[model samples]
Target: MHAITPYLLKSYKGRDTEKKESEHFDLSNIKGKDLLELLHKYMQSKSAHVYDFKEEKRVFKFSDIDFDIKRRTVSAFLVAGFYGVRSDIIDKSTGEIRFPKSESDAEVLRHYIQFTVPPGSTETIGLFHKSRGVGIKSLFDKLFKANFLLETQATLQITPYAHTGAVQEWAKGASVKSLKVKGFVPSSDITVNLARLGECNTEFTISPKIKKKGFKASFGPLSDFLTPEASSTQNEIITLLSNQGASVRTVAELNGARRTFEVGANSGGVVCDIPFAEGEDEVELKGGQPEFQSTQKWARSLTNDILKGVYGRRAFQI
Candidate 1:
């Protein structure tokens, strides 16, 4: 499985009272208590946890949470609660869609979150599924509020650590002249002006059907182009290409020469590989079994990767 590894950084401040100003507390400054234990208690309570998005309530549950005292680490899987789904089958002869109700209609999905708490450290690494909706930070914000667990008034933020070697190398290029987009399907019309004003530019517009198969384009260096249009600037064009699972390969002008670079696929988060052991078979689960053991294992493996500095120092640190 492909995963993204980001950092989870926490800071706490005391509630403001009339007598004194609110006091800030770093993870290192907290006295004699493990913050992860707060998470454990909340999960153990088995309260119904749901996230409101787009005016619809989606259920979520902390399926598996494990803390290792000796290693100072926490690993957990948050699963989307089971929802009923009806399977649709296309009739080859009649070209009609048929819906069938069966026990297989029950479906669930899970996302991963894991982090390590080193002694006296304020920042730790985190791993998250690459879904653009309802991100890791939002999930944590809903879970941990000021006094959600009485006396645990802590604020947490998860920010993308984008300063990696790959990104730095991309930035070092003199100017970007070309890019390729992948893994994106247009939900609506998308228009990209491939050149600036006063230049012979191709205004590339795509429909949902046409964009299903991704495309690549090239032009002169952006520096040589004229003023950007009101609708789309050079930066805007690049940002549009980078979003929604699109990776970019650019032809760049560097040191009076041109070179190709792969970049920005991980600008949202660092890409990690979750490979299974050779010759190890996957186990399929039935009723009364954990639905997301693979996800749980992947989260634990990513936490171990953080301790090994597999993603580089600055790339995983907050």
Candidate 2:
């Protein structure tokens, strides 16, 4: 089984955040021709996709390029690795070098990529998976920023699709009367009186047994945001967390609703595993082709499943 995550795509015109939010120009009636061309050039190696990683020169390559212009869907595989490490083998017995018999000795990392833009809609979703602690989303961000620019504007952005629906399900008709701080690390900018201690590290729990209390009442709007996926409340929380001058990790149990659940960093979205034959799912790079050659089909199936689960639409076949 393999996990796939979804992200929302947004485009901004300039550096003005307020104006960009007001415009909300996120794939709304986008022709997508220019973007498609850029991707084509990248896959063909006309434009190099290289990055420095741990003092090593790494190159990214895209293969199995499939797209549907009318449906606005693109699917490809991202293979990245260090450039040309081995060419020929050296004979230790005598001073001689010979060419390798096969090219399968080269090591590379791979991940599935899929993007879908609904017909004349503002919503766009890009499905990706992590490869060796790296994500293809970041590569796309750099790709667009370096190549797809519009007079120093038209920036491409990716916002993760949070699992707010799960939170809503747990919060509905349920009162979160307690929040326990597990590990609290103060930011360096802030001064804390540690007395004999050199640093400020604390663990505390705030539990109110009474319903409709102070902490509970003040948290109603955030609960509302989770229920409806409100962007305004989400932005406010983002600002508060970013500028809090401290790193806080909390764990709270949502009771009296459907079921109890935990909310934390990894609780942002759900991870689903796809059921596929092991051999069929694995993409072998023998002669630059897979042993089973079923990765593209697997990608299509997994993408359709995610689309059906998230957007209630399963018309994509590309």
Candidate 3:
């Protein structure tokens, strides 16, 4: 087997909110490739972005959000709610990011959660950070001797950095254009979802695509994504990607640390990391030397949690 070890270091700076803030992250796990494979799977999932969008009478109410990258975030994310999908509908339809750098394609998707509250109003609070200069594939490629170190980060303007909600990306490096989210059943309920203590999504715009076994890499236009041309199907594509992005807050913990993590991956599942304290500079893998089986174990665990969030399952399996 390929004994691939990884290392990573990252820092994040926030834009928009007052009292500008920044966070740092660290991750140098032993499960390098295993984690990478898992992350790859996550990015490839259909439910990673938005779920579903149905046009009905009275119109159950729904949302269509669009994200434009100002720069990269410290980490990327997967947010799943009511109506949307995480699957790479773009790849499925276009086979791959024809022009990942295209102002239109460089944008991030927003999942619209359609719900209803019997009597009183149901609030669907949402949290989001926007920026350009986004990128994800770089970190992915570094996993082995390969960086294994997942340097996830983006320079963003947290819509309400003070709020507890945000959006998720496959970590597929690309720039964002603009973001706009609206609609929820009853057209009133508000929803809020944020990256947990370790729930961080970040990246920079670096067009990376697969060409057989290697990547056809290139530099994507940063400004284009920031101001993409409006399209009729843009909203629909964004919705599809958003529904699939799924994440959950098990034990709500307010995390103000900006750190990065190392990773592993393959055809197997991915690794959902354990939170590392702030300023863990040059930190190594926790749990000592891991058995090959253990890597899969962690990947499986992360996959289950991700799936459960997407499907809302009490229990599950790959």
Candidate 4:
């Protein structure tokens, strides 16, 4: 389960007459009592963002929603009577204008219940809404399962000080070629490499193919990997490779393999040449140990493993 933390805020449009009507209702009027009672009754609907209150200006609100992924659950506190959390906005012509960000919406509704409601309000009610709907439930289930629940570690870390000056310089469109590092001893020098992060050496060709049957492979632009189609294709290739005796290994193994192959033939009759490792006595094995003449041995072994059952099979007749 992946967890992504997002910032949440309150929903505040310009204060209007309707707000005042609810804000300063006259207790003397029977309609006010009926209106308050109606509001209390309405706050009973179930949703993650609902809450109940009983005070002198009972601000009826929603509860704090718990988005769960594993059990495919979305338990929300609903403000029974009023749609306090507007999921969608409609223009004057009734066409939807803006849609709420789910996490933000949940946070907004939560803030309203926690901070906006007046203290000492009487008979405030809220509901918890659970869905069996295919679409709505499916979406909530996915967010709860995929985005909110998983543990994610930061793959890259950057300090604020390192980029702050560079960002300021770029914003000003200065022709600054170097960054002056601020903090250090008088005689000690701190050099920051601004170009290293974005610089790409396009002088060499990038090979996308893997020669091993048990290994996975992919191609195309890096951004394409984000799409579902691309992901499916990657998964398919991985499955095929896994079934064919190829497997994903550590970065060290891949790096070693990259250096090992000079010229090789795959089971599909695809021939290619890989670069030779310089100065090393022999190629490094997938296990990270240096093997004497094991490259050719492993290549033959893998090829035999992949072509186990079809050695003598004839080609299809025309």
Residue 70 displacement (Å), model 2 = 4.4
- Tens-digit lDDT track for model 4 on 1-318? 000011111112223686563242221122323322222233334343434322211123434433322322122333222223446554645676655533223322111111011122221111111111101222222222232112221111111111112112111221211111111112212223433443321211223566679865435322112111434763454334334332211111222232122100121122111122223214333333223233333322222212221121231110
Candidate 3 stretches with Cα past 4 Å from truth are 1-139, 142-272, 275-287, 314-316
Residue 75, candidate 2: alpha-carbon lDDT: 66
Candidate 4 lDDT trough over 10 residues, lowest sum: 1-10
Candidate 4: Cα lDDT at 164: 15
Residue-level error in angstroms, candidate 1, position 147: 5.6
Q: Which candidate leads in TM-score?
A: 1
Question: How many backbone collisions does model 1 have?
Answer: 0
lDDT (Cα, tens digit) per residue for candidate 1, span 1-318: 233445655565665787576454555445545665655666555435643322223456665677666666666666653334456666767868865544334234555666666656666556665332333445555555543435454465555543232233324334665554545544432323322322231222222223334642335343322223435555466556667434544455545544333344343235322222212213223342323565455445445435444344443321
Please give the CA lDDT of all the candidate structures: 0.47, 0.48, 0.24, 0.24
Error of 4 at 229 (Å): 7.0
Compared with the true structure, model 2 gives a TM-score of 0.47
What is the C-alpha local distance difference test score of candidate 2?
0.48
lDDT by residue (57-107, candidate 3, tens digit) is: 010111221121121111123222222322333454556754334212222
Please report, as a residue range, the 10-residue window in candidate 1 with the lowest summed lDDT.
Answer: 272-281
lDDT of 1 at 81: 35
Clashing pairs in 1: none
